[model samples]
Structures are given as C-alpha cells and as structure tokens.
Target: MDRRRTLRQRLATQRLSAAPLPRAADVVRLLACVQSQERDHAFFSLGLRSRDTTYAAVRAAYDRGAFLRTHILRPTWHFVLPDDVRWILAATSPRVLRAMSYRHAQVGLDDPAHVTRSLDALGELLRGRAFLTRREIGAAFGERPGLPSAGEQLGHLLLLAELEGLVCSGPMKGVHHSYALLDEVVPPAPALGRDEALARLAHRFFAGHGPASLKDLARWASVTQADARAGVAATLAATPGALEEVEIDGITHWFDPSLPRRTTAGRAAHLLPVYDEAVLTYPAVNFPAAPGHPTGGAVDPFWEPVIVDETNAGLWRRTVGKDAVAVETRLATGLDHEQRALVLEAARRLADFLGRELDYREVTGGPAADDAKARRAAIG
Candidate 1:
C-alpha cells in the first residue's frame, strides 16, 4: 500500500479512525497492553481507541477491576488486563529483575528470603484491608535497620511483589490508587507455559499492532530478539494464515490478514495524549507527502501530546486550571481554514472530556518549547 493508505489502515486497525473498541477492557486486550506511565493521558489514550468511553467511564472501569495498571513490558506503567497480567509478568519479569538487580541489592532486597518475607508482610497488610494505598502499605514496614524506608523502597518492593503475582493495583482512593492481592483482584485464568505465554503475547501484538517488525516487538516488550522471533514463529504456527507480509517501499511489514484497506473518514485530525500507542507501537510511521515529517521516526524526549492530521504533524501541551483547560498546538505545516477548525474541535473535545472550558491556542515550533520571541513571530 501507499504511504497515506498505510497510515490510515494501521490507524483503523488500531481503532484510531474507525469504529472504536466497545469497552475499555477490549482496548487493553486487543493491544496486548497499553503504555500508561502518565495516568491521565493514558486514560485519554484509551478514550482515543474507544467509541464513547468518557474519562469518568474509563476510571470507573478501572475501579471495577476491568483492567490493571502495573509495571509490565518495559518497567514503565502499562494498562494490562487482569487475566493477562500474571502470565505477562511471569513471561517478562526475568528481564526486569535482571535490569533492576543493582537496585534490588542497593535496597537490601537481593536476598530471596528477604523478598519473600517482604511480600508476606505486604500480603498480610492487604488481607487485613481490601485496598491499601502504597503509603499505608509502606507504613506497616516502617523504618527498620538494614531495611529501606517506606519512601525509599516501597515502590521497588511493590514492583517485586507485583511481578511475583502477589499484588496488583486496586481501586483508586481519591487521587491515590491502592493495591490488592492479585488473587483478590483478578478472576482466575488458566495458566500457560512459557512458550504459550510468549506466543499469545506475540499474536496479540501482531494482530492488533502489526505491520510491526520483530525488532519493534523486542524493543517494545524489552525482550531479546531471539525470543521475539520464537514467539512470532509460534504465533504463525498456532494460527495459519493469520499473519501476512507485505512489502512497503522495499521493506517487509507483517500485519493481520483480516484487516481491510480503507481511508480514514473526515479530516483525520486527533489530539493524542503523550505516549499514545499510535505513536509508540510502530517503527517508522509514514505520512503522505509530509515534507516536514521524517519517515525514520522522531525521538520525542519530552513525551508531549501529538497533533495528528495524517501523521505526526506537531506537538501539543496542556495546562489544566480549575475552571478551564488551556491547550496549545504547534503544527509542522500551516493548516487550512477547514483543517484548523477540525484541530480546534478536537481540542475542544479534550476540554469536554476534562469537564473544563476550552482555552485553545495554536502556536508554532517543533516539539520543543521555542523562545517567546520565536513563538510571537510564528503566531503573528
């Protein structure tokens, strides 16, 4: 397929420009997992993939235990379904454990017995109460000799416990999210062997976010290339004709055989939150005739919200005051009257989602915050 068609097709398959996924859990399930490091923006990420899911609705589902927020895939927070959480943690924790080995030693949790004891204490504390905030859980283990303070080591310990399937995030308490025992929060799903877990995850990635490469899978999952290849091979074996390879501009891309080619209706404008999967999943996203956009993928260190017309047009940032939400948009190229109106409309939708009045502004620069003088010149 051509460049524009490629972007649209992927976006449609990803539920970005088509009939959105019906439920919040469906979004997480289809994408295998979602990058949710920025909690609010991650809600917006789910919103982008759904038909009519509100921020409140998404939060409600989260509280209702439809999905879980945990350290998975890459050590950052991700929204994973409860059924998948245990296996994903089991499949991927070795890598995370190895990476965090030094921190484990530094925090005096390097000993397996000590780790098990800590988990037992945590489990007992949570069992005493349905959901305990991290602070509350940490307070139980107060400052002790050779043991890191709750502040110093609670997060690490919690991560360790989570990977061990002892704890997972529970309902939110005001602004704070609490933790529950994995057994308490998640419904039982049958266990899978290591190979089965890897295959299922690989299938989800390819089926939901495909036209993806093994390298992309490795990078996204933080697994070795050999593991990625083995998982892909297993996926192909389990479901013959499920994956198809297409050569796009002399590069091979694998995608689900079921997705049909289609154009994205309307202006194709969106205000994607920081770390939205639309930007994170693919290797190099192509934009049609976008001279300002590079096909080789751009590194966004700031994790700014993106304005997507056909591709990554520019970056955006928001300031949420009590009564109003102010959004600023910087376009890679100038927008026409119609395009600008659509962009503003998208921003207004974001304001509605936040339950605040819109204070939308369009300025220019790249992803970075340009100087005040430069901003003035661009606007003027």
Candidate 2:
C-alpha cells in the first residue's frame, strides 16, 4: 500500500477512523494492553477509543479492577487485563527483570535473598489490607539497616515486587493510585507457557495495531527481534488466514485480514494522547499527502497529536483549570471549513470527557503554524 492507504488502513485498524470500541473493558481486551504512563491522558486514551465512554466511566471500571495498570512492557505503566497479566508477565518478566537488574542493585535490593524476603514481608503487609498506596507501603516497610528504606531504592524494591507478581494495582485511593495483592484482585485463569504467551501477545498486537512490522513489535514489547519474529511466525503458522502481510515501501507489514480497508466516513479529528498505542505502537506512522507532512512517517513520536482523517495535521496539549480544561492546538497545515469545525468538535469531545467546560485555543508560533493560521484566516 502507498502512504495514503497505509495511514488510512492504520486509522481503521486502530479504531480511530472507524466505529469505536464499546467500553473500557472491550478497549483493553481488544488492544491487549495500553501504555498508560500519563495517568490522566491514559483515561482520555480509553475515552477516545470507546464509542462514548466518559472519563468518569473509565475511572469507575478501573476502580473495580476491570483492567489493571502496572509496570510492564519496557518499564513504563500499561493497562492490561487481569487474566492476560499472568501470561504476559510469564513471557516478558525475565527480560524486564534482567533490564532492571542494575537499578535493583543501585537501590540496595541487590540481594535476591533480601528481595525475596522483602516480597515475603510485603506480601504479608498487603495480605488482607485490600489495598495500600505506595507511600503507605513505604511507611510500613520501616527503615532496615541494610534494606532499601525510602525514595528511589525503595521504589525499585516495590517495582521488583510488582514484577514478581506479588501485587498489582489497587483502585485509585481517591486521586492517588494504590496496590492490591495480585491473587485477591485478579480472577484466576489457567497459565500459559512462554512461547504460547508470546504468540498470543503477537496476535493481539497485530489485530489491534497492525499493518505493523516485526521491528515495531520488538521495540514495544522489549523482546529480542528474534523472539518477536518467532512469535509472529508462530501465529502465522497456527492460523494462516487470520493474518496477512503486504510490502509497504519494501518492509513487510502484518495485519489482521478481517479488518476492512476504509477510512472514517467524513473529516474526523482527534487529540491522541502521547504514547497512545495508536501512535506509539508503530515505529513509523505514514500520513496523508499534505504540505509540511513528511512523505515517510513524520510524527516526532513525542508530542500529543492533532489528527484529521488519519493525518497528524498538527500537535495539541490540554491544561485542566479549575472550571474548565484549556485545549491548545498548533496546526502544521491548513484546514478547510469542515476540517476546522471537526477539530473544534474534537476539542469539545475532550472537554466532555473531562466533564469540564471547554476552553479551546489555536496558537500560532513557527512558520508552519503561521502558514496554517494565515490559511484559516483566508478561509474564514
């Protein structure tokens, strides 16, 4: 597929241009897991994915453990389903544990003997408490002569606890997140072997974030390139018709064959969060033909994106004030009448998600921004 089709196909696949997913539960289940380091933006990510899920709704689901937010997949936080957590950790934890070994030592958690003892103590601390905030846990884990007592080292110790499956996220304790015993919160399911776990994760990634390449899978999951290829290959071998590949710019792209090749019915607009799976899952994302857009994947991969019909037309950010949320858009390209209106609608959608009044502005700065401003002025 060419760049235009590639971008459009991705939009459809990620449910950005197509009909949205039903609810927060469906969203996490379908996408496999969502990267959610930015807590508030992560809620919006779920809001954006669903048909009409509000921020309140997402939070409610989270409070009930409909999905879990924890440190997984490259050391950042992700919202993974409870049942999927065990298998995914079984597949990826060894790599993650190895990656964090230096931190483990730096934090005085170097002794596996002590770390194991710490987990035992922590498990005892959390056993029937239902949930405890990290700060609360830290206090209970008072100063020990040789043990990690407080701050980063202590935090790493807790991180190790999480990786070991001793605990997982509890509901938000008011605005602060808390932790619960994994066995208490998560419903039990049969375990999966490492190879089977990898294969399952591979299938989910392609189904939700596809027309993607093997390299993308490796980077996102923090698995070896060889493991990623093996996982994808296993999925291909098991269900040949479930997946298909195409050469986009000479690179092989794997995708679920069941998704239709279509874009949104009209000019759609979005304020996709930074690290939203739709944006971060792919190493390089193609865009529609527009001035200032790179012919190749041009998104810088850091900023929040302003999308119009599968194109990252510009960038955006939100500031939550007392009474209203301020949404500012920096356009890199011109928008026509309908496109401009669609962007406003998108901003309102965000405001509605936050249950706050809309305070929207389009700021102009650089040459591209100035050009876009001039074009919008002319159009008006």
Candidate 3:
C-alpha cells in the first residue's frame, strides 16, 4: 500500500472513534500524539498546567503513570509518560546539559560533586513534605552557611533535582506553589542501559512526532543529528507500520502514519497561555492567521492568551481587573469585522473561563505593538 493511503486510513479510524470524547479529553488525547509521556511542563504550557479542565486530564494521566515529570526535549521539565521518560531523558539530557556546561562553570556550579551534594540536601528537605513554595524551599537553603543566596543557589539546585527526577510541583495552593519529592510522589522507574534507552526514545519520538526528519528530532531533543538518525533507524526497524513519509512542497517529512485524516468539526476556540504546546510544537508557519495578521510566531514567549483560530492564529494577551478582563490583540494586519468579532468572542470565552468580565483592544505596527517581544527585550 502507498504510505499516504495507510496514513489516511489510520487517521480515519481515529476520527471515527473520536466521536464520543469531550473537547478537553480530545485535546489531551492529541497531546499524547506529540508526547508519549505526560509530565505537563507547567511553565511552557500554562493552560495545561493551570486551567481546571485541562489540568484535570493531565493530573489523571499523571496519577495513572501515563505521564511523569522528566527533564527531556529542551532540557526543561516536560510531562512525559512514565514508561517513556527514562529513555527520552537518557537520550536527550546529556546533550542539553553539555550545552549548559559552560554556563554552569561560569556560575561556579560546574562541579559534579558539589551539584550532587546540593541535590541530596534539597531532596531531604522536600521528601514527605506536601509542598513548599519556591520561597520556602529557598529559605531552607538560605539558612545554611556557605551556600549562595537562596535565589541563586536554589534555582540551580532545583534544576539539578528536576534532571535527576528528585522532585516536582504538587497541586496548586491558592496561587502559592509547592514542591514534592519525586520518590514520594511517584513510583520508581526501571533503569535502562544507554543504548536501549536511546533506541526507545527515538522510536517513541517518531511514533508521536514522526514524518519528522532526523534533524527535526535532533533539534527537538537537543541531541546531535547522528544520535537522532540512530534513533530513527531503530524506531523504523522496530515498528514499520508506524512510519509514513509525506512529500510537502517537494520535501519528504516523516510523521506518525496514523494521525487523524479529517479535522473534527467544532474545534473549540482556545485562549491558550503563552508557550502552549499547540503553538510551540510546530513552527510559526503551521498556524493559520489572517493574511498578514501579526502571528504569535513573531511574538516572544512570555505573553499570554494566544488567540487561536481553527488552526493556531495569532497571539493575544489579557489583563484581569476586579471589573473586567482587558484584552489586547497585536496582529500582523488589521482584522475584518468578522475576524474582530471572532477575536472578541474568544476573549469573552476566556473571561468566562476565568470568571471575569471582558474588554477588547488592538494594536498594530511599531515596537510597542509586540507586547511579548517588548517585554522579553526589556527583561533581556
């Protein structure tokens, strides 16, 4: 069979079976398409981490061991499935860590022995504790002499512990955050030897985000292209049925052959937070926007409430006050009446979701227009 036909059939099967699932559940299911493990990285996908509806689905996955917290992909915390985390982390983390090695040295944290000791001490403080706000945890370290300022030392320590799977955030505490020791919160993952881990990760990556080139996997996993290619070969050898190659604009891209063939009707309008995976996973060109409408692709990452049409549209931001939520849209071009109405409706939905009132505004052209970009530049 032609590979494209097989891919279409697989998608058809999924669409037929997707009939009864709720919107939030459906979104969560799609998340599994890109990530085999679910550790719900709170920072990147704020809505998945914070919204009640999405968070519930994510937590359920976590509780079931379908998702776990591991340092994977970008060397940042990612919510991956328990079965997949070990291999993904093993395959990817070293490269990411290596890139940061120089930064560690400049910051006086390059000593492996010192980093390990700091992790052990931090873990002991967090074990069995329900949750400690980052501040509280920092205080624990600050009390110790010869330690860098809590702000400085604790930041690096937490990153190390996260890489080691020693801890993760617990449920939200009224806008205050808490952390729990990983050993206490989740079961131990079986250890995998290096090559086995690398092969498994590569296979899952293609399975979830395949039709991707080896270079794409390498970029996404922050590993060398050689390692990524090794993973690609291993995955194809193990599961030939799962691979499919598609030619887009004369370029062959490998992706999961089984992804759904048709777009579901009534895909809900979402007010995705900054760094939502839907926007972050693919390049900016993948998002659908009004011709010339400023797309989130051009926006920096700190902005919130990215307004997505059926496909990723452009980015939006909202500020909530006691009376109403003020929405600001920065588009590449002016929106027509219908597009404006649609954007307002999205804002209203967001306000309702957050239990606030709605207000709308737009800004186009000039440096001040790019809210996210401006904020990031300011910080830099």
Candidate 4:
C-alpha cells in the first residue's frame, strides 16, 4: 500500500486537507466533538478548520452556545455541541468514569448519596445564575456541610455533574471557563436507546474520524473493543454503504465513502493543535518512515504536531508575548527547502488564527522523554 496516499486520504477526511468549512460551528458539528482541554488551543482547533476565522470570532460562537465544552469521549475536555452532549455522555461516561475510578476514589467522591447531594447542590446553584467559574462554584459548594468540595475533590464533583448531564460549559467569564446547569444551557434532549445511541456514536466516529479501525474507535471513545465492534457493525448494517472498508497490509479500516479518495494537489503542511483531530484522533497512524523505524513520536498530547506532507516531522510549542506569538519547532527530521517554507507558513496560520504577529524558531529534538512516559502512564 502507498502510505502517503493512505495518510493523505485520512487527512482530507479529517477536514485538515479538505476545503475549509465556512464557520467554526460547522467544523465542530462535522467532527462531532473536538478534544479541547487547552481553551486557547481548542479555539484554534476550530478556527483553523475554517477558511478564515479569528480567536475572537470562535470564542464568540462558543459563548453563544454553538458548542458546549465538557468531559466526554475518553475522560478529557471535548467541545461537543449542545445537540450532542446528552446522548454522547450517556453512551460514553460509564467507561470514562471507570477509567477515572482510581482518581474518583482518591478524591473520596464515589459515594452515591454524596454524589447526588453535590449534583443537586450544583444544579440549584447554577439554576440561580446564568454562569459561574469553577472556583466560584467550588467555593459555594464547599459551604455545603458534609460534602467533599475542595481542590481535586471539587474538580471531580464538577466532572461528575458534567457526566450526569447536570451541567455543561457556560459562557466564558473573563478568561476562565464557567459552568451552568445543562437545562438552562440547552433545551431538554430525550435520551437515545442503548443500541441506537451506540450506532449513532459509531456512525459519528467513523464518519468524522474514519479510515479508522475498531481499536481507534474503542481507544478514542473509551468504549470496550467489543462495544466498538458492535457499534461499527450496527452502523454499517443500519446505513449500508455509508462507510467503505479498505485493507492496508493486514489491517482493516473504514471511512466515509463519500469523502474524496485523493488529496488535493501539492505538498501541504499544517500547524495542528495539541490533541488535533488529524494528529490524535487515531492511534493506528503508520507514517512512511525509513525501514525498521518504529513510529512517529506523536502519543504525547502536550506537544502540538508539525505536519509536513502528511508526516509527523516534529512537535511544536507556542509562546504568546504581548505583540507576537512565537512558534518553535522541535524537529526529529530535517526539513527540505520546500518543507521549511511550508512549516513557516503553518506558523503564520497559527498567528493569523490568534490575530498576532508570527515569531518562528526551530530546534533539533522531540518532546522530553519523561513527559511522554509519565503522560502515557497517567492515561493507562
């Protein structure tokens, strides 16, 4: 199989190499839910998918409830739409909670009665106001007697409220994210049945992050591998020919058949955000490396990827100063003249999205080994 062709096809399907969407909201709806832990990077993740958009514009849409950021799809922050939040959480939160079980226990937050009280309190508190930051909510929640509501414990309780559909992302209060009752944020959404929910989720995953394997689905959604298989099967059976399967070596992958099979002409580079859909949505990406090379060093979500012609040639970090945003590249492989130009242009794209001047730099290394190791261990 031609690895370049496969990679390009997947990138195009991810909307990275496709014609840009008109608006940031369109981008989020297309991707189902985008990984968005870093608020700035999350805004860029949406803005970069559009033809031309600014951080202010994207944040405006978010404040308008175009999408609601919350804990979903594998126990991390994701920008899920209000239309999608309830069903997606219902389908995925159990496994995420299981993954978070140790941390939940560490915070002494697993008690059913205690959780109910916290949620009830949070719901009532948020119902009184349109929005409140985490710290604001935490302080008030701490006032309630016999409830664990401080530090990591408060954070977990908020996460629980999110998972239980009691609250979602509220309007940005200054620079900090706030939370409000889900009911006030969006109209009531009836829950979907288990099988139907699974099928809808599977369809969204494969359609949005397609040319992906069952393992990718399971890993990304924190569902069981078997659950992933069942969802994929049901989605395929329910909507015949929506997805097409292809075999590269011995691995089977599925993608939306309607998306272009060929990438647009010319070499391209993208300053993909940290936890970018193109970079982190799939664990099965096998880039065209030299013989016997293991894999691209991309599992670290902390380092944003520098994609040069569909290969992960490096990781990048950004430093925002008053006048300009400096983007520094830590390269594992040297870039040719064309690739160097592309990477510089990609840096410019980030600056444009952030509405700042570009200050670019380069170096010769990947992410710190200890950082990647500890992160992988933490997630595992």
Model 1 per-residue lDDT tens digits across residues 306-361: 44656565666789898999998766564566666777888887887778899988
Candidate 3 lDDT, tens digit per residue, 159-185? 666665677656545555456786676
Q: Where is model 2 poorest over a 10-residue stretch in terms of lDDT?
A: 293-302
lDDT, model 2, position 171? 89
Tens-digit lDDT string for candidate 2 (321-378): 8789998776655566687688889999899998999999986643343346655776
Clashing residue pairs found in predicted model 4 = none
lDDT of 4 by residue, 187-248 (tens): 88888997888888888887777778888888888888888888878888998887788876
List residue ranges in candidate 3 displaced over 4 A. Answer: 1-71, 193-196, 206-211, 267-272, 294-297, 300-313, 332-336, 362-379
Q: Predictions ranked by TM-score, top down?
A: 4, 2, 1, 3
Q: Which of the two candidates, 2 or 3, achieves a greater lDDT against the reference?
A: 2
Model 1 ranges off by over 4 Å:
143-147, 286-305, 366-380
Select the stronger candidate by lDDT from 1 and 4: 4
